[model samples]
Target: MTRSWRPWIAGATGLALVAGAGVIWSVRGSDPGSGCERTTITIAASLDHAPVLQTIADGWLRTDPRVDGRCPDIRIVAARSADVAANLGDARAAGGSAAPSISPTAPLSPSESAAAAASAVSDASRRPTVWAPDSRAWAGLAGTRPEAASLLAPGAPSVALTPIVMATTPDRAGALEGRITWPDVLRQIATGRAPLVLGTTDPTASTAALLTLMSLADTDGDGKPTAAEIAGPLALERTARVYAGSVDVLAAQMSPGDSAGSAPGARVSLFPATEQEVLRLSASGDAPPLVPLYPAEGVAPADHPYYVLNAGWVSARQRAVATAFLDVVLGTAGRTAYAAAGFRDRDGTLAGLTSASGALDAAYRGRPLPGTAALTEVLVRWRALRRPANVIAAVDTSGSMTEKVPGLPISKLAAFRQAGIQAVRLFNDRSRLGLWEFSSDLSGSRDYRVVVPVRTMADQVGPVSQRETIIAATNRLRPHSATGLYDTIDAAYRAVQGIWRADQQNILVVMTDGRNEDEDGFGLDELLGRLRAAKNPAKPVTVLAIAYGSGADVQALQRVTEVTGGRTFVSRDPADIGAVLLSAMVNR
Candidate 1:
C-alpha cells in the first residue's frame, strides 16, 4: 500500500530544478575545505525521494558537516531502486568485499526520463556506499539471497511514505470504485476481458512492480506463488512490456508512437502506482488526469528506507558521514522536506498535497510496514517460486521451407528460424524447453530428429545454457526432405506427457512452412484421434500449430490443435512471423 513513486514535485528548489531541467547533476559546492581535507560522499537516493534527499542533505551540509575534521562533498544521486538492486544483488552473489571504484555517476539514458528517471542508473561495473530505495520491498528482495541479509546494514528508518493505488482514466474510476483487486485485474487479463493494456516496471528493479508481481502471483493468498498462478501471467501479461524504471511514463506509452496494439492518439493505461504519482502527474495539467482506485483486497504501503551499505567498500569515515546523514533524515529537516513534496512523514502524517491524490483522496491512510522477520519470509517464498514455464516447440524443417517467402528477402524457414530464437528469450530460466526438427527420413525411417533434448533453461549443455542450445540448433537449421508434420507433432505431444509436472504449464507448439509431404505419414484424421486418445484430463498437453507462408495447411493445423485443446496461428506473410510467433507463445 505504501511505495512513494516517480515525478511528484515537492517544495524544495532542488526538486523543482530536477523536475524541470531533466537531470540530476552532481554538485560540488564552494570549497568545504577551508583548512580541512576534502572527501566526497555519494548518497544513492531512490527517484521517489531524490529531490527531497538532495534538499535535506544540502541544508545539513551548510552546517559544515564533516567526519574526523574532513570537509565532505555531499553528492546525492537519483538512482532507480531496481538498478541499485541488480548491482547490489550481483555484489552479494559474488561475495565481493571491496568497494566499487568511484566512477563519475552516469546520467539517465533517455534525455527526458532523467526527470522521470526512467532508465537504469547504476553502472553494473560499480558499487555505491549508500542505497535509499523507496520501499522495504527492495530490502526484502535484496535480502532474499543469504549473504545480502548481512551484507546490507539493517533497520534504516523511513524518511517518507506513499500508498500504492490502481490508477485509471477519470471516466472509468467511478464504475470500478471498490470492486477492483489485483486478482480481479489479473483474471480479466487472463480471461481476455481486460479493457486496456496494463503497464508495469521490471519487478526486480521497482518496488511497486515487485509488490504487484507478488500480488499477481499470489491469487490464492498463500503468500507464495505456484506455477499455476504464474502460467496465466506468463502467457497473457507477456506483452505488457516491462519498462526499465518509469511508472510516470506508462500511460504516455499507450500512444501508438510508444508501443504496439493501441490505436494512434489512444493514450490510456492502467497500473498500480503510488498516490503521490497520480497526484503529482495530474497536477502537471499537460496530460489527461488519472483517478486512484483502491483494491477490495488491501495493498502494501511503501516506506522510503535509507540504507547504508555494509560491504567492505564502506569505510568507517563513509559510515560515519552516512550515519550523520541518517540523523538529518530522521529529524525535522527531513520531515519538512518530505511534507512539502506531498509525501507523508514516517508516522503517516500528510501535508501539502491532499488534492494531489486525485479523486479517491478521502482519508487515505498508509498501511503499516511489516517487521524484518516477516518481510524476509515473504521475499524468501517469492525467490523460491517465481513463475516458471514448460514449453516444447517442434519446428518444420521440410525442404519446401527453403522456398523464399513472396516479396520478402528471406525464406520461410529463415524467418521461422529467427522467430524461434526470439521466442526462446520470452521464458525465464525456471522454465523447461525442448526442440525438434522434422522432415521425411531425417534419421533412418523416422520423420523427425530430436535436435535439443527437453531440459530446463538453467541446465548447461556442455558450455552453454539449454536456451543457447535451442538457439544454436535453430541457427543451424537447413530445410530438408518433405514435411513430416503430423507424426512429429504427435511425438512432441507424447514427449510433453512423459515429462509433464502438475505444477507447470505444459504446452507443445508445432511450426511448419508446408503441409505433410510424406506419402507414408499418418493422415490428419488418424493424428487427431491419437492426440485425443492420449490426452490426460489432469495433465493436459496444449498443442499449438503455426502455419508459415500461404503454402501451409491452416485448416488441417487448426483441426490438429483443436483435438488437444489448443488453437493455431497463421503467418501468411513471413514478415508477420515474429508477431505471430509471440502471439502463439503467450496465447492461452
Candidate 2:
C-alpha cells in the first residue's frame, strides 16, 4: 500500500499559471560551453503537466542542478501524449535511429535531395531525449517499435495518477449519484438515454480516448480482451456510436457552470476526461461545476510514466540529466506541484488537493493496462469497426496516364489501379464504395460515368467481398481521352450531397493526372460556386483529392478540397503514389 502524505496546499498562482496554458516553454540552468561541450536534454510531455514540469525545472536550474559530474540545461516541449508515442513509433519503425541524411557527394536530383532532407528533419524533431506520456496504455501501442524495450527504463515510477471520469453538470450527476460503469454509460449512449451527447478526444491522437475505447471493448470484466472479444459484432456496433470527434470539440460546446443555463449553441452532454481535467473545469467557474463519476466497474488512470529514450543520440551527460529530472518529479517538491495541479499521488490517494471537485475515494486504482498484443488487437479491431463510410472514387483516365512511369514498368494508370485496390482494404465491410472514370466524352455527352454503383461490401448482389469487386474493376481502367476534372468533381459532390447518410462519413475521392480539358463541361469557377452554394456544416461531406504525377493541376485541386475542410495529396512520382493514397485514406 502507498502512504498518503500531508495535505499541502499550493498558492492560487500555481493554478492560474499551470493549468491555463496548454504548453510551457523554457530553458533552465546557466549556459553550458559551446557545441559538443554543452549538454542539453529535451523532454516532450503531456500538455497538462507542462506547466508543473516547467516550474520544477526552473527551480532546479536556479540552484545549479547537476547529474553525475556535469551541470546541464533542460528544455521541455508540451505535446499530445499520443503524438509523442507516434513519433517514437515512427523512429522505431525506421530502424530505431534517426533518418539517414542525404549523401552530399552522391549524384542526386534536386527533388530527391530535398525530400530526403525534409524527412530527416521531421524525424529528428519528434525524437526527444525523454518522453512522459499521460499513461502506460501507450506502451502497448508503442512497444512494437524497434527500440521499445530500451525506451522505457526498467522499474520506471509513475509521477502522478488521474482516473478517467465522465464529466457532467452537478445537477445531472445528482440524479444518478451511485456507482457507474463503462457498460452502463455505453448502454445509455446506445439507447439514446444519455443525458448529454457522449464525446471524447480523437482516439488516434489522445491516450485518454484510446483507453476509453479499450475499456468499452471488454465490458464483461475479463481483464484484457481476447481477439474474439475485440472483433465481435456487438463491440463494433457499441464503439461506433461512442466516438464524437475530438475532445476539444466537446470542450468548446461546454458552458462554464449550471447557473449559465444551457445557451443557444452549447450542447455537449457528457465528456470523458481525466480527473485533473474535471478539477480544472470546476476551477474555471466559467462553466457549471462538473461532477466527476469514477466508474464502479474499473478505471484506467493515467500514471504518467517518465521514460528515458535509449537512443544513440542521447549522450551520457544527457542521460544523467534525465535521471536528475525524474528525481525532482518523484521528490517532495514534485509531489506538492502535482497536488496543486489536481492530481492524485502514485497510490491513487488525494494528497493536498486544493481545488474542489466531486468526492472520490482513494480506492479507484484502475486495472493494469492490457499486454502489448491485446492492446494491438483492440486497435486493429477499431479500424475495422469504426463508423462505416460512403466513398465515390473518381479517377481521371486521360491520355497522360497512358505514358509509362520513368522508373517502373507500369503506366500511371496501372499504379493508380494498384493504389485503389490496396486502399479499399483499409475500410470495414460495412463501408459503401463506388468507382467512376472521368475524361472528355466519357459517354456521348457526359464527361463522367459510374462504373460501379456505391454499395456496402456486405451486399449480396455482388461478390462476397465488395472490396474485391472494386479492386477487380480497377484492372479494367484504361486511359483514352482528355481530362474532364471540373465537371466530374461538381457532379460527384452534388450527387453525394443529395444522398448523404447521417450515420456514415460521406467522401469524394478524386484521383487525377492532368488539368481540365473538357470543351463543354462546367468550368472550375462554376464548380466551386456549386460546392459553396450546397455547403452544409451539419451534413458535412469531405473531398479527398490525389494529384498523381507532375502534370496534375495540384493548385486548382487544393482550392476545391479546401472549401470542404478536406485535403489534397500530391505525388510528383507515380511510383510512390500508392503510399500517399494509402496515407490519405487512413488519416481521413
Candidate 3:
C-alpha cells in the first residue's frame, strides 16, 4: 500500500490560548441558529461495519428529537482500519494555517462506537463530534485525552460485547460432545476423523479475525502461531477445509442444502462468533438453525477504542460540541445500545445469559490471553523454519533495455541496474541472493554471481552502501548478449541445489524483459523436474517470476510460478520493477 498524506495550509491570525504555557489555538464561533441545515462529517470506518454505522446515523438523524432540528449531515468516509490513522494524520497536517481544524484518527479501525469516541479524544484540533465503532476494545485502545475525554468509562458502560463462539452443525457437535478445544479441532481435521468446517476473515484486513487467531494461539498453549504452525503437517493436511474471506462469505459456503451444485456432503460447520450479536444476525426463520459452540478454552474480547489528536488549531465551540457528543455516547442509553448489540456489559459479566452448556467446559475459562509479543515471535520463527530461498535476478543488458523511455532520460537498463542494486541489497540481508545478466550470444554467457549467500552471513547488512558497487559492475556490461532465459534459470536452479538448506524455503525470483532462446542443455521439463525433486515429500522451493516489457513470456513465467508455488508479475513500466521485487521479498 502506498502511504498518502494530504497537505493543507492554515489561515493567518487565529486566537491562541496559551494556558500553563501550552499553546492552544482556537477558532472562535457560535452555534448559529441554522437548525436542520445539511452539513457533512467525513467518517473513516472499517468496511465490515460501515453498513451498520450508516444505518445508525440515518436512524439517529430521523428519529431522535434532539438530533432532528440540531444534527448536522453525517458523511462517512469508509476504509480499512489500518488506513484510518494514516489518513487522519494527513488530514490534520493539511489543516495547518490555511484549513479548518478537524478530529484525529487511530492506527487501527474502531470495533465499536465507544472506541471511536476514545480515538476522537486525541483529535484536539480536528475532533470528530460523533463516532461509532464495532466493539468496546477500540475504546481501550483510544483511552482518554486532555482535549477529548472517554465517552464511556473503562468497563463502565458497554455498547456491545459478544462471545467468541464456534459455529458447527448439530450433527458435527454430537461426536465432539458439543464442547470443543483447539487441539481437538486440529486433531479431527488432521486425522480426517470428522468433517470439520473452519472459517476466518482475512486477518490482514479484519481486526476481529486477527483477535480470533490470537485467541486460538492462546488456547494451544502457544503464545503465537507461526506461519509454520499454520503451514505445518497438521495444517497442510487440513488445507482442503480452510477458508479465508469475509464472515458472510464463509456463512454462505457453510449453509446446508444451499450449495448450488457441488458435492452432496460439502457443508461448512464451524465459525467464530461475537456472542449473541452474530447469532441473532445470522438467524433465519426458514433456514437450518446456526448453532454456537464456545470452545473449551477462554475467549478474548474485541476491545475497539477511539482516539483523537490534540493540536493547536481547534475552535472552542467545536470542542464543546465534541465534548457533548462524547458525554451522550458514554451515558446509560449508549451502554444499553452496546448490550443490545450482543456485547458484554462494561463489567465483563455475561449478564443473565447462560453458557452454551456442553459447548464449553468450565475448566477452559482459565486459559491465558495470547500476547502480541508471542505472536510476533511465532511469525519470525515460522519464517526461519521455511526452506531457504534461492533467487537469480536475471537482468537485461540488451540494447533495448539500455534505451531511454520518454520523459525520463534514464535508460530501461539503468532502471534495471538500480533495481538490481536494490535486489542485491535485499538478498544480502535475507536468504541466498544472487545476480545474473543475459543478452545476445555476442557477449557470451555469465554464470550466477553469489552476491549474498544465506549460510555465509550471521548479521545481515542494509543495501544502501552496496549501491555504488552494483552500479559500477552493471555499467560494465555491454548490451550484446543473447537473452538465454531458460539457460539462466537452469543455471540458477543448479546453483541452488548445490548449496542446499534442507529445512529452508527454497525460492527463485527471476527478473527478465525478453524471450528465452539459448544453447544451454536445460529444457523446460528438466528444469521443472529439478525444481520438484528439490522438495521431495515436502513442498519447499518457490519461484516468483517477473516479466518486464511486451516481449516477455507471461504464460511460461506463470507456469513456472505455479509449479514452484510462487507468484508472477508482469511490469510494463520498468520503474515498477523495484517495488514488485520488494513485495515478492517481503511476502516470501
User: Candidate 1, after superposition: displacement of residue 459 in Å?
Assistant: 30
Tens-place lDDT digits, model 3, residues 1-588:
011123212111211111111111121111335344323333334443444334444444444323223444443434444323212222323443322122222212234212322222232333333333444333323332212222323333233445566665565566463446655666676566665655655433345544555554444555655322332322322333544445556666665533222445545566565555345545543334566666666566544343322333433443444444335445555455554454455445654334333332222232343554553442332333222455545555555666664467787777666665544443322345445665645333453344433342223245533334444565665565556666666666556556556645566667777766565645677767766665443445566788877777888788777776779888877767666655455456
Q: Any runs in candidate 3 off by more than 4 Å, and if so which?
A: 1-88, 91-158, 177-179, 218-244, 257-266, 284-287, 309-319, 352-587
Tens digit of per-residue lDDT, candidate 1, span 34-131: 56675556666787788888777677767766677776555566766644443343334445532221101112233523433322233321235577
Best candidate per TM-score, number?
Answer: 2
By lDDT, who's the top model here? 2
User: How much lDDT does each candidate structure score?
Assistant: 0.65, 0.68, 0.46
In candidate 2, position 421 carries an lDDT of: 77
Q: Which regions in candidate 1 have their CA more than 4 angstroms from the true location?
A: 1-33, 66-68, 89-127, 144-149, 175-178, 186-194, 220-222, 231-245, 253-266, 351-353, 356-588
Backbone-clash count (model 2): 9
Candidate 2 has its poorest 10 consecutive residues by lDDT at 8-17
lDDT of 2: 0.68
**Better by lDDT, candidate 3 or 2:** 2
Better of 1 and 3 by TM-score: 1
